[model samples]
Target: MLSTSTVVITSFRNVLALSVLIRVGLILYSEWHDARSLVKYTDVDYRVFTDAAQFLLHPGPGSGNRAQGPLGEGYGDPYTRETYRYTPLLALVVSPNDWLHRSFGKYLFAGCDILNGILIYNILLPQQTRSKATLYTALHLLNPMVFSISTRGSSEAVLSSFVLLTLYAALRDRWTWAAVMLGVCVHWKIYPAIYGFACIAALAGGGRQIRMMTLLKARRILWFGVLSVSTFALLTGGCYLVWGDPFVYESYLYHLHRLDHRHNFSPYFYLTYLTYPSPTVGNFTASTSDASISISWLNDILESPLTSFVPQMTLAIGSGLVFGYHLPKTHLPFTWFIQTTLFVVFNKVCTSQYFLWYLLFLPLILPRVTMSTTKAVLCISVWVGVQALWLSEAYRLEFLGVNVFYRLWIRGLVYVVGNCWVLVQLMQGYDYSYVTRKYVESK
Candidate 1:
């Protein structure tokens, strides 16, 4: 029989080889698909990056031709046209793609995804046997969501890579690196700031007695906090100095005013659609009426200040407190996952890509987590299945103009319930001894 060490070595080699093969296949497939031309498969957000780079590289003659200045001054679609919604750091990151083909951006994202897989593999090495570690790492590399996001040129993959590096650094007790990585991620996208409290708590050490007093007393925690704040201030202040108020407004303040009742998959979207159904629902012949109805619904939702804000604020605060309560009680990795998952789940905008934020952390904790195999399979299935159903509804509205508005609330409810179930299971942390027994028996 092969020794355990030899078996582990073999598994590691196999995982590395398979990871390369899968990534190469995805790259080739993306090239063949020509995602840049296909609107459905292509990432619309990527266009913003490339467009901003083009504008910066070659400025237009007059103000009219100055690439809309990131505030969508005269453009049709503010989101894409006023591409300054993101921090200038991302535009600078993608500027090189202007000289190369647009497809090169996709390649760069793919490479980052592969690097994330390696990071995950290394993080798992100390906790599990080599075979198990390799398998967990493969789960991240082979995830469909990861593949789709990386190939389509969404920067979530890059953001997630940085976030994972921060988590890994924290796990290794490298507080300074963790702080630096977290600052880098927050600069890329502000949402990662949600993890700030959890990082501080982790640095302060885990237990029931952990409090503000305890955290303040720890020299390492104080330094970490200082470095993190300094990093964020430097990056954001530099952007402000360079581009002025437009950079600040578009990058940070715009999100506060985002009311996407018409073209979004949030539960809030369904709530608005229910209150005001499109005319297309009743009269299929009136295709033009759909836009007017959607606009009316959006107007109502936005104009009534409390309609959307109240519920979102309530959920945000309530879920945040709950996650904070459990942060010190659970393991750091799982705590980080819970914190991120709750943010995505309860946020006003729950995009499909946002799921990647928590999903990337799942593999790191999978080996340490205890759960029945059956329940694990059920949770995974329902999570992906609900997303598929929502995608279908979105497709009907976007492509076919079917206006499946009436049943949207049902889908929203189902998605929320499924997410809650999975989250509960993860928090419970059931023993995996039975899962191991079942596997051995089957073998």
Candidate 2:
């Protein structure tokens, strides 16, 4: 009879093989279904990506031509009318898909998911048993959000792969590599810039130290800042040189002034909607085209009394400083998880794709943390459950032509509450023993 260890290892290998096969099979199915459709029922963002790629490869004044101006007007093609808000790097990444079918991009994103799974497994190998690491990898591969986003060609998968790689580099004490990867991620999407502070905090040693040690820490932080900024400048500056101000305006500034009043997953959406309810069209309801509605209330909130900028900046900076200070006192992986989570929670927009930013890291940290399996499951379930409720209301409004703003607002409130509760649980359950021991040893 085989020993228990041998049997366990064999079983794990089988599970790993099966998981890969299933993921690949699902991806192929999605590609096939999308290809066979007469209308091509993929996400609109995918079409936007393809259109941007086409325009980049063949600049023209006809169909799929690039648009200009703040509203991104002046395009014959509706899809291409809105300028691509993502970095030029994403356009370059998707440019090759112009020759191939759109499903190819989805395939590439699926491949990214696979790569992320592998990275997660390897990242955990040093701190976790092979069996536990394998299980974590499987959990990541099987996550429903991962499947939904990757199959739909969302860039979150690619962005998340960069984030995991950055974390992996940081854990290995490869600060330069971490900085480079982070710069690349920030170029792809601006949100990952928050993690840079976490990286700096991780590198900065913990505890009240002597003046000389403080100086050394300051020097190291300065070095990291220079490397990261230089890397970011190289990538973005090159883009600026090539594409000029339009790229900068559309990619960066547009997001800053974005006024998305649509009923998405954001709690802020409810506040905006309640303050500035959408006007009813003849028989239809509030939609994107109904831009005639007055946004004076939102404008006032953003510009007067307290100014939205003040609170947003304060929350962002305050959270970063607090997390950075405590990061050295908590497990790196868990603290990174909380840092990303808090950033999303405090963001101006919290879409489903945004959740993918931190969900991919859940399995890697969950296995290493001290949180009980039951509580972890409960927390994840509640988080996902509230999101589902909000999505249902969104589907009703967007797809079924039903006006459910009231229901959506209620669900959004619940969703926000659920996220806050989960965040609290995560903080309470985080394992600080590693950092505590390190501090003790240093002293």
Candidate 3:
């Protein structure tokens, strides 16, 4: 017969096991479901997949001008389907779509995500550290919102991996390598240029950047600047040799010039158009809440295609400078990176999967700090899930339905609450000189 103590411990163990299984199961479900959404046999996505596959093999790169639609009704659509905006150089990775089916590309992307997760944990871990960072990294991957990007074949995952590598190189004082890697990431998506600039600024802004390790001064500035500009130029120009027009090779840049429509994320544009539309079509009554009438002026501003992606450009520059200047070395880089991501998120016209670009860095950044294991994991997991919800709301509404929006908004609220909790914990740690016993014991 077992002792009473054994019974109590066994019962608690069972409860814990159940809770863990539920959590893991949810994460797996989230990943698989989001992935399956793109491959459903009876849907528009299947049609797109089928169309894209046919073009992948038959299309001749030698064709001078390609008609664009889905892209537009002009010389843009490369395949008579969607205007392919991605640089042809990236085709090395993306081009396999021509041989067989659309799912092939997506599966390759999924593999990249899993590999990325492993890379994150590997890089974040300290050989001789106080606590394991993998728990936190896994938490970040499981962030409630992150599922959207991981499973959808978004390029953000690849870009994010490059960014983390860039930052890691910089922290280790490998300036040249950092710039080269960052340039590659930026070419993937122009966003990483902001991060690269931040690294350069932190190295340059000697007065503001406290040197916990080395006192980097003006010399570092010149090297960083030269490397970034020169390497980026080389790759950008070189990419022309690989695909279409080097200049117009990337039609997406043109496509994104969305002076025509606006999402709520763009602060100035949306507020301006929502309150007083450009055509001055404000206060118009919708036939039904269900009937969607896109505010035309808002769409015009986004679709205008002028050199007017002002807020995004300005925010990228300002954030790179401001936070880069104020960034603390002892503070984990995740604190800084995550905050920058928030600025981008709140300030720009980001799509759903954009979070994957920054989220990948959390594993590397969080380990450098002194946070509890459970808290860290919870933060990242909810974050990934939240990203998934956000993506589903923006890009896959019919599949996830409106219910996912509730999850998206709730995840945001949870983030607010968690941040407050962190604030409280930080105060205790700084004021009293140690984290509370609750954090340590629970983890």
State which candidate has the highest TM-score.
2
Structural RMSD, model 3: 9.6
- Answer with 1 or 3, whichever has the higher lDDT: 1
Query: After superposing candidate 1, which stretches have Cα over 4 Å from the reference?
Result: 1-10, 35-41, 62-80, 208-219, 272-330, 430-443
lDDT of 3 by residue, 216-243 (tens): 4666777777888787777766654333
Report the backbone clash tally of model 2.
0
Judging by TM-score, tell me the better candidate of 1 and 2: 2
Q: Hey, what RMSD does candidate 2 come out at?
A: 5.6
Q: Lowest summed-lDDT stretch of 10 residues in model 2? A: 70-79
Instruction: State the C-alpha lDDT per candidate.
Output: 0.67, 0.68, 0.48
> Model 2: per-residue lDDT, tens digit, 360-438?
7787667545777899899989988998888888888788877777678788879878998998887677665543332
* Clash counts for the predictions, in order: 0, 0, 38
The window of 10 residues in a row where model 1 has the poorest summed lDDT is 434-443
Model 1: which residue pairs collide?
none
> Candidate 1 at residue 214, lDDT?
57
**Model 1, 386: alpha-carbon shift in Å?**
2.5
Model 2, residue 378: distance off in Å is: 3.2
Per-residue CA lDDT of model 1 for 1-443, tens digit only, reads: 98875564448676666666766676677667764555356577777778876665654555533334334343222223465588766776777878878766777787788888888877766656767777788788878778777777787778878988887776665778888888888888887776777666555544445455554547776898899888888887776655556667788887765655444556666544434434333324334544554577666764464665576555544444454444442355666676677667766567777878888888876776687789889988998898788777767766787756656556876787788798888767732221122211222
Best lDDT among the predictions, by candidate number:
2
